[model samples]
Target: MVDLSQYLPILLFLGVALVLSSAFVFLPMIAARFTGAHKPTAEKLTEYECGFPAFEDSRSQFDVRFYLVAILFIIFDLEAAFLYPWAVSVFKLGWLAWGSMMVFIAELALGLVYAWKKGALEWE
Candidate 1:
């Protein structure tokens, strides 16, 4: 049988991490209950610093264009992230990796063009 003693340090480290993390999370909440001011007033409870009273519901409809642009930004951003690691390893990985990355980039470019044609990128 493989000696389980080799894993003892890892198990101890995990146990320490769990105890410390739980303390960090719950200690603050326990302290806050004893230390925080227990007061509620009408003005204090209302939303602050808006000069006029809120006219519309806070959860209001947003432009679909905003979400489209956000999603495009995230997609392209993740593509760059993936490219960085591949770029660093490219010398060792050679032509196959390079060709694969080129295909990935071409696909992203096509998506960008499609979004442009669909007017998903237009602000106005």
Candidate 2:
């Protein structure tokens, strides 16, 4: 047979949370329904960008080089993030971690060199 005591608190907590949230929503909905507020207009519903009039054909294109640089920045930034946790446990990981990180650094260095050779880092 399942123990009812173990689940009692959890059930109570869930019940109370449900009741509290329901009360919160019920009060706001009741108030709003009775307010009889003015009907919304186009100015209220239309999308506004800092009070500028909406433009047609919002589709826009960006430079490919901009995307390439953004992707490369994210990749290298994530690599640095991994280094932090590994560094914290460096003593426990010892030489194996050191060698692994060395390999990783070498790979990144090679990538940097490749980007340099490909003119990916150049502005012009």
Candidate 3:
């Protein structure tokens, strides 16, 4: 028989994690039931954190500008994320890496100018 002792710790760890997670999730539910706070009313069911119920259908179309802004934000955010690592390693990587990073920045600037001229930055 294959020695199963080596797997005992992993199995025990998973079993404990399962029990703890179950208690954490269900304990609040059980406490609420006994604390007279389990009541669910129509208004509570319909409530929103924004203090206003949703007016439009859930599947209504979003504005094109919303997508444009999101894409631009993600692009620039990724550029910043990459820039930090390149900055840290540029000396070790020599002049080629520095030149490539400069080109990347130039391309980002060109994209920004294009978006600005095309009125992608405008709202309404």
For lDDT, the strongest prediction is: 3
TM-score of model number 3:
0.63
Which pairs in model 3 have colliding backbones? none
TM-score of each candidate? 0.65, 0.57, 0.63
What lDDT is obtained when candidate 3 is compared to the true structure?
0.97
- lDDT of candidate 2 over 55-122, digit per residue (tens): 56567777787887887898799899989999999999899999999999899989988987987877
Name model 2 segments beyond 4 Å from true. 1-40, 45-57
Consecutive 10-residue window with the lowest summed lDDT within model 2 = 49-58
* TM accuracy, model 1: 0.65
> Which has the better lDDT: candidate 1, or candidate 3?
3
| Off by more than 4 A, model 3 | 1-44
- Candidate 1 backbone collisions, by pair: none
Q: lDDT for model 2, please.
A: 0.85
| Cα lDDT listed for each candidate | 0.93, 0.85, 0.97
What's the best-to-worst order under lDDT? Answer: 3, 1, 2
Tens-place lDDT per residue, model 3, 8-59, is 9999999999999999999999999999999999987985787887888889
Question: Which is the winner by TM-score between candidate 1 and candidate 2?
Answer: 1
Q: Which residue pairs collide, candidate 2?
A: none
